[model samples]
Target: MSTAHDDLDNEHTILPSWERNAYAWTHSVRDGHIESRRMVTDGAIIDVILDGEPRFVLDLGCGEGWLVRALAARRVRALGVDAVSDLVAQARAAGGDFRLASYEDIIAGRLSLRADTVACNFALLGKDSVERLMPAVASLLEAGGRFVIQTVHPLVAGGDHPYSDGWRQENWTGFGAAFPSPAPWYFRTLASWVALFTRSGWHLCEMREPLHPGTGRPASVIFVLRRR
Candidate 1:
């Protein structure tokens, strides 16, 4: 799911990105919109791998590969890939072995490289799109490898569904982000996400939704999956 950046969806997707569109790539992935990813990509993601002690990791939709660089610092064998050119150049310059390709291409068996673990932090993948990308992600891993993905919670991402109105009243929150016109996100519930993961051939081994520290409720859904 290419957020607002990808030109695929004309409708306002619940996946609101920082920039207006994927074509607008001058700013960083963190620069445009949605502060959620900053937290998701920073320590939370690294913790998943670091704690698990994954020997090899692949950063899906790696963007500029900041995460990959961080993974490298842990001495983990990590690789990253993205669909953008300049970002790929930047990632390489940063000493990350970043590739210029989409997960779809690699998943379709178009690429030769593979990894032991695949990580996707705050990447948006549509229902069908994830199906296509999953096998490729799984393929990169050795047997019993891990696949970790994070995205907008479905409850928050509900803004993506086709609506009769321009933007539905129920589709927004103060922090919610939309697609197309920058409406809000299409948030999925915990059940919705679990279903997607099981359908994608992953079995949920653990789940975490970090809170705002004082609210005592989940702030976001984080899942650690293992290939079944």
Candidate 2:
């Protein structure tokens, strides 16, 4: 739908230790509200999908493993994975079994197990990573399993300054998302976002644009994808 939103990959590491670095940035900016906000949003999504039942889950990019703990508390079989080792260890200690590896390495063979749901919440990597990750997400889901993702709203990513349009970005892996420059993010429009799901062989079943607490404008777009 969108020229693949594919055909590109990052040669650089982007941002090393994204788990810790992102948390640091969030804590700094959100002033201890990052975790709470993430929990509320993520829990809300997970709840509707499960419908008051215990669902087997894989928490992708599961930093600090908070969701894993939440799922486990609800008697759900929750497994967590992250690209950062330290985060994995901390996650494992918190509750569920956690692994430190990229999505490719895990899905390649090591953790080839499919689950009732695969979730990547509040962890929007650049385009290349998302492209790479989505395929694996599809593969790791049982028929009818859900693939839910919450990313930075593309509108929000493209900052709007009064005088200028802000630095426009056509790609997600650009300097901002991959660095600590406090740079603007590269968000996906609603149409483009749906196009990605279609191209990836998934269908969007649920959608929402919950407004930010302070800002009256939309804060985020949430999606629930099912294998086609």
Candidate 3:
């Protein structure tokens, strides 16, 4: 059984785990080692973003700036923001416009950025941070703009755990040996996610499930939202 204290501790460990594995993660992303990303979720997110016809995009929690580069390739102006210094350095070295700011900083209005769309790709991994971050993100979007999020499908990611929202440990199975300590993430059920969006003053305009080719199950879920 897990206590609220344990949940808090796990949430706190998320950033440090990423800090330690930043290099390994960058390599994996650039080298395209993650099969699910290489085949499905990457394109799924890019497609969704492009479909929005966004002229300017903010890649929230953009790891290593791949999405920024990709969007830039399509002639869409983009800025990638991340809390990990090493990852931001790597992104800058790769010619991406990257900023180093944590979720807390963004929530506190540290970044004065506005965009037609804000994309968070597989990065909303916490409990409180995410809940608070959403409203702040809404302030960063232009009118008639959208907030897009891609995350592992709750049904698939839940595994054998109970179908409820809480903190869960990541094993980082396919990420190889370099990731010594995997981050623990807060899992939200579909209903919880919907409720969060409402509470954060957003309305879910669309929801998409991108499927895994082999398993024919959803690999991830994308939520497209508009300010309420």
Determine which window of 10 residues in candidate 1 has minimal summed lDDT: 163-172
Sort by TM-score, best first: what order? 3, 2, 1
The runs of at least 3 residues in candidate 1 whose Cα sits more than 4 Å from the true structure, single-residue gaps closed, are: 1-41, 155-187, 214-217
State, as a TM-score between 0 and 1, how close model 2 is to the true structure: 0.75
The digit string of per-residue lDDT tens for model 2 on 1-228 reads 222323232212433535435544433323434433553456565665466253688888777787778788778898888876766666666567787767667547667788888888766555555655666677788877888787656556546632221222333232232334332223456776788788878889888766666666555667888888
Count the clashes in each prediction: 25, 1, 0
Please name the candidate that would achieve the greatest TM-score relative to the true structure: 3
* Models, CA RMSD each: 6.1, 5.6, 1.1
The stretch of ten residues in a row with the least summed lDDT in candidate 3 is 173-182
lDDT of each: 0.61, 0.62, 0.92
lDDT of 3 by residue, 1-228 (tens): 458788789878999999998999999898888999999999999999999999999999998999999999999999999999999999999997999999999899989979999999999999888999989998789999999999989989999999998888887778644786778999999999999999999999999999999999999999999998
What is the RMSD, in Å, between candidate 2 and the native fold over all Cα? 5.6
> TM-score of each candidate?
0.71, 0.75, 0.97
As a whole number from 0 to 100, the lDDT of residue 89 in candidate 2 is 68
Candidate 2 positional error at 84, Å: 0.8
Error of 1 at 180 (Å): 11
Q: What is the C-alpha local distance difference test score of candidate 1? A: 0.61
The list of candidate 3 runs beyond 4 A from truth reads none
